[model samples]
Target: MTDIPEELALATLACRAGQYQTSELEQSEALFLSSSFCFESAAQAAARFSGDEEGNVYSRFTNPTVRGFEQRLAAMEGGERAIGTSSGMSAILSLVMATLVSGDEIVASRSVFGTTVNLFKNVLSKFGIVTTLVDMTNLDAWERAMTSRTRMLFLETPSNPLTDVADLQALADLAHQHGAQLVVDNCFCTPVLQRPLEFGADVVVHSATKYLDGQGRCLGGALVGSSALMEERLVPFLRSAGPTMSPFNAWVFLKGLETLQIRMERHSRSATVVARWLDEHPAVRRVYYPGLESHPQYALARAQQSDFGGIVSFDVADRAAAWRIVDNLRLFSITANLGDAKSIVTHPATTTHGRLSAEDRESMNVGEGLLRLSVGLEDPNDLLCDIEQAIG
Candidate 1:
């Protein structure tokens, strides 16, 4: 019912992100489900295609619903524009494909998702594109890894599964000094808790299928950046390559955006409770959560993020022991996905980051006993009791 507007706070923008109430108008944002709209005349259609007029021509590159989602997400992210993709991986692919030529390099974090690691080593390697993965916490590694060929610095802060905090300001500064763009995956905190661009990241990416969708119902990803880069470079690649986010899924994301703030808050509160409890558990070896007072980067996280994210990673004594706890949990889900309303859990070494070699996993401290928990909006006491029962 409410009109989506540019002049809004992050919380308000979430509720308003993609729905425009136009005409005599309905209260809720309308889903324009038609694949194509008939133009008033042949000349009008030509004008629309030629960019002389502003309206939807096809659901592929241009659609009201998808555009609405893009606008809303972009607004919420504090980005100039956003382009939604079919998946988070697709968004990364589109970004690299569009911006880099044959010789450009990427300085990425080693603690990224396993599929992303594969994309860099396997897929991008074939094209003469070089990616150097560095310790996310070690600024020295990032600086030493950079070369004149480097065009992008890509990382996921409070990185996947481990919740390793990369100093965003430091990474951004280093990248910019070397004439590189900083691409941050804002999937973990979403805009509800953190805005990477505000901390000097040049571009922000998201697995909207996660927190942005909030319900785990659809697959989607997004790239948010300056309008110049998003429209001129990314949009052209998306138009040709066709990894475009579907209109129906975009509508779903739009719906998800409305409650993003509240859900993230609850997720954070619940996660902190779990992380704190785990730190005291006899089976737990180490807990990695920015929210914890004992975390190495706790101060930095507090300075930047409004709240700690839902993800909490911990280590048990051994692989068998970790599996014992994970296998015993009844309420938590054993899935790779995070940022859902229902709590999810996974053993990173054998699941999310399983593809990495032993050395790679070891360097990042992702062990057989490493477990990542994505806390949801469940009762904290119930979740904690479930953990106690599982580990006992």
Candidate 2:
């Protein structure tokens, strides 16, 4: 086991953060593929299960590979501990289930992922957990919606498709005043860019299935927070519910982390180039990249994130035109998933946000003409050419 030096740079941490080295002294982190660990005696097994001793007991809630990924991510996010989950949605589910009871309420941003909205509005509602949706950037709206029962505040900054940036510090302050925990989904801008915990947020969530994997290879998610919360709350929920991350996925994420910083930096550069081109193009009605000077929260994005992330969204003439562009694109993958090496183009109105009611979609401004692009590590000129031909 290794402890990363406090002064190491993020680039260094990405590659060196996790505790590694087995009896064989392997340079890379070993994947513990076994489903359960064998102990020397029944006493030792009881000790492991009862928390009287520290060692792997079962892969469902304890695995060295998964623990390594959690430790590395926690180190990167500046949190005391991190718990890995099966997927991004499961991370949010585990958080809610672990901390909030049926009578509690949640204040969430309307600009979050559509699946998150479903989880809150449809799924959690069945359990008597009420939720209030508010504009991510409107502090007054957040304050107005708070109630005595509010237990959690959730949002995704530089929100999905639109790149709507939220004031993390302000929201965190507001949540604290109401005795609610502020949970920030840092999926778009990994710890390499924005760290919500640094801005007073109580918890940071990540869809490790996205940029954390760098490639679209594995599914994983994480929640990072104080050790007390992870040990006392999240661990129990995971132990009982069994929404734990697989050791194989954890190993994949570990490999992805080794190159995360470099990938994000390149993704940012290419995305900026493509976004500027789109902003000037005649076919584009509007661009939603925080890197652009035209973005309303450009200053805040610059102040908070290391760079504008890889996603670039814009409006077209209509849904017909948007679909035509998606159909014509030769280089981009027409998938809902983003944060990949290959560019992805999606019509949020018909794809990601399709499940929501029309009124809800309208409220989120996910119009028929909207097109979201998960910019990749491709040549900007080639992507521009694809757009040029597709737009025509």
Candidate 3:
């Protein structure tokens, strides 16, 4: 692979970080679509399988295209290494399976994706791993939740559905004081907007299906951390469990990374406009966007992130009004997924967080009236017009 200078700007690194040309010297990245690589000799095969030599033996654990994606994303995140996985959820699962024992505990934010909440509370509980949920914004709650058995502290900054920003540095400090790793879900704010590792987080995870793909084209996820943690713990679990990212998807993500910085900037700019529009609208009771001065964590967001990100959420009168607005929208796709070139709108209480108990949803602030919008690259004026007609 080509060696990218660490001192280079992020945009330069994104475009040029992980290219390893073959004899063809292709201008664009070449896709290695084969399931396995050919070895020069039987001894070479043995050496590869035995980890004595560095070469691609199988697609499941090692592929040139996948390696390129991992390397580029790692560079962008400023991490020592990165590992790609099948999907966002699989990345989180791999991290947990690799690092924690059955008796270990997790301290997680209640403001995470609903599926993540289910994974921690329902699935992991069956294996004797307990997770304690807390408010993402409350330092006191996070500090109080830590225990001797706590192995991980997990959260999403600019949290899902609500756009709640957490203080990453404070949480990282608190986690380390308790001998725990702070694992941030950098899904909402891709590394283009916010690099959590820079703020003392031990590991940064991504739902590359979102902004990384940028067009809602593929499903992928990744973990970025010290090379020791990735190679020693995460890679083994990925190899054994077979939650591997496809080489084709990795190639697609590589292309996505090239445009990520520019796309994120556009997303942020348009989202700010949409957020402001919603904030002032008579129908919107509350607008949750860190870019707004009215947001509780606006100052922290300005300090920690390059931009406030693309997701904008707001509250209306009730579920009826929320559904009415959703049904009325002609331009925005009503889907649970976010981070796309095309705008998307979702009612959290009925869609993303529907599985959670009503009490749980209420506690997390995912109320029946809340509507989450993933403001896309569409003209801000057009988006506002679409929203205006819908709200009416």
Model 3, runs deviating above 4 Å: none
What lDDT does each candidate get? 0.90, 0.94, 0.93
Candidate 2 per-residue lDDT over residues 1-392, each given as its tens digit: 67667867887878888867789988889999999999999999999989999998899879999999998898899899999999999999999999999999999999999999999999999999999999988999999999999999999999997999999999999999999999999999999999999999999999999999988999999999999999999999999999999999999999999899999999999999989989989989999999999899999999999999899999999999999999999999998799999999999998899999999999999999999999998888899899899998
TM-score of each: 0.97, 0.99, 0.99
Looking at candidate 2, what is the lDDT of residue 90?
96
lDDT of 1 by residue, 92-182 (tens): 9999999999889999998898889889988998999999989889999999999999999999988887888889999999999999999
Q: 247-303, model 3: which lDDT tens digit per residue?
A: 999999999999999999999999999999898889899999999999999999999
Clashes in model 1: which pairs? 1-27, 1-28
Enumerate residue pairs that collide in model 3.
Answer: none
Model 2 Cα shift for residue 337 (angstroms): 0.8
The candidate 3 region of ten consecutive residues with least summed lDDT is 1-10
